[model samples]
Target: MPAGSFTMGDSSGDRNRADGETPRHQVALSAFEIDATTVTNDDFARFVEATGCITEAESFGFSAVFHLAIDAPPEDVMGPATGTPWWSGVKGADWRHPGGRFTDLEGRGDHPVVHVSWNDAQAYCEWAGRRLPTEAEWEYAARGGIDGAKYPWGDQEVDEGGWRANIFQGEFPRRNTGEDGFPTTAPVRTFAPNGYGLWQSVGNVWEWCEDRFHPATYRRGTTAEKRTTVTDPVGPADGQARVMRGGSYLCHDSYCNRYRNSARSQNTPDSSMGNAGFRTVSRRGAER
Candidate 1:
């Protein structure tokens, strides 16, 4: 992707906006080369086979799975968390077994690898000689050369023949009607690419960025500062969780409407779930 500028977050009047996405400000970024799609199971498997590296989910022995994905008894499959029961901690649910003990990545080699924590993503990036995109760079690339466009496709309705992105349909958690032709993670590049040729930058799986999560990190600049754009701004210094941009398959207009380019989310660095994955970026000037 070439160097460009765009607003980093959502505006005040932006519908379905979250508190963290306030104080929309301009961000400038230099040219960088990002993965066309999130790291897939095949990509991660290659790294794992080469180094015998085990993921956080493998060490933890379990990761979060959507309730609908786990069909067995609660005692057999791990129980769900009290706060958000939509995500059930299913035993044997690592990146290899995305749904639970019953599921495996047999034919889904090209699908984005989920149940990967931020640390796992970092390790993968290091092995690939790349790094996770900074929050600014992620949003800039996601915008696809269209400044202030709601989505990577530039303000197109998501349900226009469901050609936009893979997201939850019918109902969330309980039932995914698969109206978008996907009840779970779609194969990377199932949809068309953005202007920058990046695939599923808005939806599919939420991507991890190299930034700490701060609800309101991009402060509203004083009049003078507002006129000036921030260049490659990193997130705040102090925060427990890292930032995750874009939304997951569970995102829907009825619930989480975070598929827009400016949307944001987060999770602990060690937290791995079925809904999250990541892409990597390499600086253009770096020797390949």
Candidate 2:
């Protein structure tokens, strides 16, 4: 973690949705340590080899598979699979089998491991002697001293002649030319790191925070969100789902741009998909 303050919401010039990221407020965070990149296939493999931890997606026997990896033609692609057939409920899909069918993490050991749920992430953190950062800490570290800029890099458009992060570049759900050097997910740290030396805090995948998802928690709550200032603001006690930050490769400006620093979303703790993964944080004196 890095000690700093940022505007903590969408700026005045931002035309994005103003619901979750409204009334830009000041946020301060203390120094902490976050993973240089998301836990990759190789990283998770080490944990699995040691602990024999089977992820929920692996134990449950099915995980969400991106439609792009399916055999369906472009015209055959349908609605959101998590709702419709947009995601294939493939057997054997887990951190090892990203696509669930015949795909494996064989040659792509550096790519960020997917199909991990909140429970899975927490278990990994415990095994690694770290914990998930709160939503506030995640945002603070993600800002990278830019102070409330739209993205981890800055407010400039993504294609401003530099590789800022990995996300959908072309028209989504139809064509992806891989102009960003990746159509799905580039390897973790495929691009540059933020000012604090944090990697992939904005794209590649949406990381799970320790906080619970609350629609108005930031505005009206007795817990972490409402407190004016604190050392480490953990989220609410209970909720339907956990908070997810730093949107995923599936994020698109035309659709889900929650990849922005202020943007947020959530899912059930047990739900695992290709677009959701996580990183861990360690306190100053905590065991490494």
Superposed on all Cα atoms, the candidates' RMSDs to the truth, in angstroms, are 2.5, 3.8
Model 2, 254-274: lDDT tens digits are 877777888878889999988
Give the Cα lDDT of each candidate: 0.83, 0.76
TM-score of each: 0.93, 0.88
Name the candidate that leads on lDDT: 1
- Estimate candidate 1's alpha-carbon lDDT, on a 0 to 1 scale: 0.83
TM-score of model 2 (CA atoms): 0.88
Q: After best superposition, candidate 1 residue 101: deviation in angstroms? A: 1.3
Please give the lDDT score at residue 134 for candidate 1.
88
lDDT of 1 by residue, 119-238 (tens): 999899888889888888898888888887888887877888666898888866678888889888999988888888899997789999998887767763313467678876777778
Worst 10 residues of 1 by lDDT: 11-20
Residue 9, model 2: lDDT of 60
The CA lDDT at 258 in model 1 is: 88
> What lDDT score goes with residue 42 in model 1?
97
- Clash pairs of candidate 2? 1-32, 1-33, 81-86, 81-87
Q: Of the candidates shown, which would achieve the greatest TM-score relative to the real structure?
A: 1
